[model samples]
Target chain A: MNRIACIISYDGTNFSGYQVQPNKRTVQLEIEQALKRVHKGQEVSVTASGRTDAGVHAKGQVIHFDSPFRIPAAQWPKALNACLPDDIRVLSARYAEKDFHARYHTTGKEYRYRVLNAEDPDVFRRHHSAHVSYALDIDKMRQAAAYLIGTHDFSAFCAANTSVIDKVRTLYAVDINVHEDELHFILRGNGFLYNMVRIIVGTLLEVGYGKRTAQSVDTALRTCKRDDAGKTAPPQGLYLWSVQYND
Target chain B: MNRIACIISYDGTNFSGYQVQPNKRTVQLEIEQALKRVHKGQEVSVTASGRTDAGVHAKGQVIHFDSPFRIPAAQWPKALNACLPDDIRVLSARYAEKDFHARYHTTGKEYRYRVLNAEDPDVFRRHHSAHVSYALDIDKMRQAAAYLIGTHDFSAFCAANTSVIDKVRTLYAVDINVHEDELHFILRGNGFLYNMVRIIVGTLLEVGYGKRTAQSVDTALRTCKRDDAGKTAPPQGLYLWSVQYND
Candidate 1:
């Protein structure tokens, strides 16, 4: 059996996120169903790098599945895209080694959180971005993000429900960029706990808004208590940009 | 009394055009309802630039409503946008002259039709564009479009149900530009009869595919018969771009 890797993009608006939930629609379940239709009526199971919450979109989410059928690698992308729903698309497909796992083999990951920084609410992008009406000092946000990089206990930036015993995680990079109407938080990390990225973004946003200082990030990182961190931004603004692998 | 004008943009995927209909939801009716709520229990009526068929979208569609209660012109754009549904947005608003009419005072109009010219469909833009997998010659289409410009009898390109007696119309410009996977057909005209723009685009697309020659456009214009033109393209790809007035 050959391991097939697929790069996917999804709107995630109508989905219950990337995981398969019983009796609920999800991006992973839809992909599996489409694979079944394309693979001669055989039910297929797929494993992804990570599961995103509902309403969280993706650009380069990776997944892998083992199949008995032999099909051209070039045809797999089109065939899967045709069978998949309009909100989800298989961008690329390739054959990989048997030991290649989408989740376990990941070396790092990148995520972006978009906040629509505007006075008036954006009606069209309401579902795709979080609207922040208050003015923010992006320079301060950038300064605060500098403190977030490197290995530290991220329990303060994680959700209360996270079951991980080790709160230490290595953040490779964090950058904040501001456009006319958007503020983007791009983060690269070895691994992220539940809502860690969003919480970090929220804390940085508070610093940008003058509610907290640039040292607030260091304070949150040092203290492994969840209550010391800022709130989690909405899931709609969060996107799993890409998963890294050691080639 | 105030004559309020509003510029609106809509994603027509879920709308039944911009006009009111019995038992049908329309952009006009939705805005009117929102106005009624703002008018302190007074029912209101709205007039738009023209009627767009169901599923057609607009970016610069204009409308006017007569109101006894005055709303600040600067604030009206936000007021209506806030109360209106997510699919429709009021881009701008101004108080118009008492005799100003959105349809009658229009000096010229612009329309654009988008065709996705790629083998693989774009899932995110599926609702806003028409998918055409076949190869198209942009030069051929542009050459064919030249013949359709200027004043001529456009009955061949008009829909069968069009009630206009004079089918003669002047097309100021017909541009066919292709960028990567998208083809934009931007047409500027004094006015368009029902399905005129779509039929012209369809005929030009046929010319691009070598199914018809560039000379066929002139022949169709001279013939003044509906059979001489190609089929009407889908409404989803059509956008009422802007309406111009001489003031």
Candidate 2:
């Protein structure tokens, strides 16, 4: 038995997301179906590093599947891509040890959220970005992002429906980069709860728009309440950038 | 009545191009309907620089319309954008002289054809560009493009079914620029016949791939026969970039 690992990229525009859902098209299901076709008639289950929500895109998602058939690792990527849909692509594939796990072996993860900061609507970016018409002070948003780094209780940033009780997570860094008509929020952490990155982005936007102060992020972390944070950002602007694993 | 000139941009993925077809949706017909809605039940006819083929995109298409209503010229661009579909956008609008015409007053026309030169299939660019798996020599393509410049009878470049009798046309320039994995063919001419740019691009590609020689272009032009040229490139990769007028 071989633990086969693969890197995947998907558009996520017409998909329900990275997880399997009943009767709905999903990135996992599509890739699995493609794998099944290559395996002749055997069924395969894949485990991903994380499950991104619907409308959330991915560039370097990592997944692992166990297969009984001994197939050449180098040829698996091309075979998968040949059978998969155009919206999903298998970037790379390799054979791993039986103990290798895609989610459990990950050391860190990176996510990015994009916001279109402009008055006039961007027709080309309507589906891929969140539009913010109001003027935002990027300096203030950058200042607030510094407070969220390091180990802290992120209960305030998590969604209200999150099942996890332990809210402590170590955030390695939070960087806010601003372009001409777009703002990118890059977050690196050991692990993230449900809707945590989107909530943090929303809170930072409040500080940028002058509705909240730079210290508000620290206050929200201390409160340990979900209501203290801003609304969750839309799913379209969120992307699972990459997952890091220590071999 | 002042001639209202407007610059339009469209994705061209859904519509049947700029011209109105019987019982089919078109960019022109949709904009006209939107203009009628804004004019409070008045009909207006629009004339464009050239009729783009189906599935061909445009960024700087010029069109002119005459109306009896006195709408502010500065507001026309925004007003038209608000009513047009998401795939179409009015970039700019202004009032021109009564004698200004989109097709007649045009002095030069620019068109660009993009080909994705790669073996790996790009799912996202499938609809926007042509995927060519053949290896091409950039320098050879550029050398062949130089022979196509200046004035010549372009009968061989036109489609075989075209009905135009006058085949003489002046080509101001023909440039072949290659990027990382993209080959862009930019052509500037006084005017182009049906599928002329696509045919030229196809023939140049044959030259670049060593399937044909550069001398074939001149020979085909002298032959004055459509069969002498290569096959017409796909319409998906072609874009009507801009139309210059001597205003």
Candidate 3:
């Protein structure tokens, strides 16, 4: 069997989440179903880089699965896209080394959060962006984001219910970019815990709104307390921008 | 009585059209209903610059309504948005001259057609852009668009069943811009006939695909026959960008 890796993109608006649930729509379930069709009804389990919450979009999520078919790697996207739904697209496919694992081999990940800062919500972008009508101080948000860069214990940024014992991770960069009325938070890291990106964005937004101070980010990291951070931002504004793997 | 002019925007994926029809959901009906509620159940008539077809979006549609209440014009958007659905928004509102007519006093209109020219469809933009998987020659399309930039009888580029007798209109400009995998057709004209923009876009796309030559546009213009032009493009790709009035 050939181990094939693929880069995929999905619109997560209608999905329950990236993982499969009983009788619930999910990005993984749809992708596996499409693969099953290609395999002539044989079940094909696919492994993704990570799970994204419901309503969280992805532009470059990676996945891998073993297949018996010997089709050309370049033609895999066309063959799989014929079976997949419109919301999920296989961007590229290639044969991977037998030991390559989509999840375990990942070196880094990038996430983006979009905030629409305007008095009036945009009708076209309502589903894609989180609307925040109040004024935001970009300088404050930038200041808060700066405190998040580098290796640290991100327990405060992760979901409280996560069972992971090790919450330490290395953050490569944290950037806040403003375009017109939209603020985009771009986070790149060696790895991320559950709900980490959303929580960081929420905390920085609070700093921008003057509800929290820039130094609070440092406190949250040092204390490793989830309660010290701000509320988790909504899923609609979050996008799995890309996943990185050591090639 | 006060004459209120509002700049509105809508995602037309769900509506039948912009015009009010019995038992059919429309942009006009929603606006009128919102106004009635704001006016304490008193019916208010509204006039728009023009009607957009089903599945056609708008970013800057202009509408005028006469209201008996003397609320400040600046507060109109906030008040109406409270009652309007999420798919439509009142971007701005202001007092208009007593004699200003939304439909009659309009001097020109701008419409945009978005074409996603890529192998895979973009799920996030599925409702907003038209996808064409085939390769298109941009230079050919630009050459054809040049022939369409002038005053002419556009009968060939209009819907066959349009009741309007006069098909002559002055086209101020027809620009084709390419951005990544998308092509934007921006058309500005003194006025347009039924399905005129879509038909023109269809014709231009055919030229881009090498199905029709650049000179065919001139022939279609001279013949003024509906059969001489290409088919009408889908409505989802069209947007009423703005309306210009001689203020």
Candidate 4:
């Protein structure tokens, strides 16, 4: 059997999420089903780098699977793409070491959140961006994002139901870019907790709206309470931009 | 009654076409339905600059309607948008002269066709562009496009079943621009026949693939025979970019 690593992109609009759930349409189920068809009824399990929530898009998601077929690495994308749906595409595939894991071997990740800061929402971007009619002060948002960079225990920004004990993670960068009527928030980090990036964006947006102060983000980090931060942003605007690995 | 002209945008993925048909969802039907709701059961008729086929998007389509409401011109978009669906949006609205007509007062129009010239289709652009896997010679396409410019009888580049007697039209510009892996065909013309732009694109694509020489476009224009040109491209890649009007 050969181990294959694949980079995939998916439009998460119709998916329940990236994980397999009973009877729910999901990205994992589609990928595994396509693999099964390619393997001629032999069940094949696939593992992704991580799970993304429903309605969250992906540009460079990584996955690994073991297959008994002898297809070349470069032709795997073409083969699998023929069986996959239009919304999920296998961008590239390559042979990987037997010991390589898509999930545990991941070193860092990059995420992006898009906001349409316009009076009226764009019809074409309805599924790709979140609309914010209220004016946002970009300078204040930048100041609040500055407080989010570097190492911090992001328990205040994490989801309440997550059982992960260690909330400390090193944030490499937080960039807020303006593209005409859209605001793109790019975050890079060694790791992120459940809804951490969304919460951070939500808090920073509140600062832009004058509902919170830049110093309040520092206070939230120190307090480490879920209520200290802002509400979690919606899932549609978030994208798992890329995954990093130390090969 | 006051005449109001509005600039609108639509995704066009879910509509049958721009014109209303019995029991079919259309852009015109949606806009008229929204107007009816705004008028509280009073019927309102809308006239657009032109009709676009199913799956053909619009960025700045012009429409005119008569309404009895005395709402401010600037607030018309917001008021009408509240009643319209998410796939359609009113970009702007303004009062127009009583003699002005959306269909008859148009001076020119701009249309764009997007082709994804890549090995693999992008998931995000599935609904926005047409995927062409084969490598294209852009220079050949540009040369063919140049032959299509200026005033000519475009019967060879129009749909075979079109009943329009006069196929003569003046094409101001036919530009083929390369942006990364996508090729954009922008056409500005005084008018177009049925499937004119799409047929032109299909003919140019044939030239790009070396199936036909650039000189064939000139021959096709001279002969004015439908079979002399290539097939008609699909509608998804076509966008009614904007409509021109001389005030």
TM-score per candidate for chain A alone: 0.97, 0.96, 0.98, 0.99
- For the predicted complex of model 1, DockQ is 0.43
Which ten contiguous residues of candidate 1 chain B have the minimum total lDDT?
B119-128
DockQ of each: 0.43, 0.40, 0.70, 0.82
Residues B101-177 of candidate 1: C-alpha lDDT, one tens digit per residue? 99899999999999998886765567788888889988988889999889998999999987799998999999988
| Model 4: native contacts recovered, as a fraction | 0.93
lDDT of 4 by residue, B59-156 (tens): 99999999988788988998889999999999999999998899998999999999999987889889989888889999988989998889999999
Candidate 4: segments with Cα more than 4 A from true spot: none
lDDT tens readout by residue for model 3, B44-111: 98899999989999999999999877787778999999999999999989999998999999999999
lDDT for each candidate structure: 0.88, 0.87, 0.93, 0.93
Evaluated at residue B49, the lDDT of candidate 4 is 97
For candidate 4, the docking band is high
Per-residue alpha-carbon lDDT of candidate 4 for residues A1-247, written as tens digits (9 for 90 to 100): 8999999999999999999999999999999999999999999999999999999999999999999887778889988999999999999999999988999999999999999999888888898988888899999899989988999999999999999999999999999999989999999999999999899999988988899998899999999999999989888899999999998
User: Looking at model 1, how many pairs of residues clash?
Assistant: 0
Candidate 2, A54-116: lDDT as tens digits = 888887899999887677777888889889888888878888889989999999999988899
User: Could you tell me every candidate's TM-score relative to the true structure?
Assistant: 0.89, 0.88, 0.94, 0.96
lDDT of 1 by residue, A90-204 (tens): 8898999999999999999999988999876654466678889999988888888898889998889989987789988899999887777998889999999988988998888
Predicted model 4 interface RMSD: 0.7
Top of the candidates by DockQ: 4
Model 1, residue B128: what's the lDDT?
80
Docking class of 2: acceptable
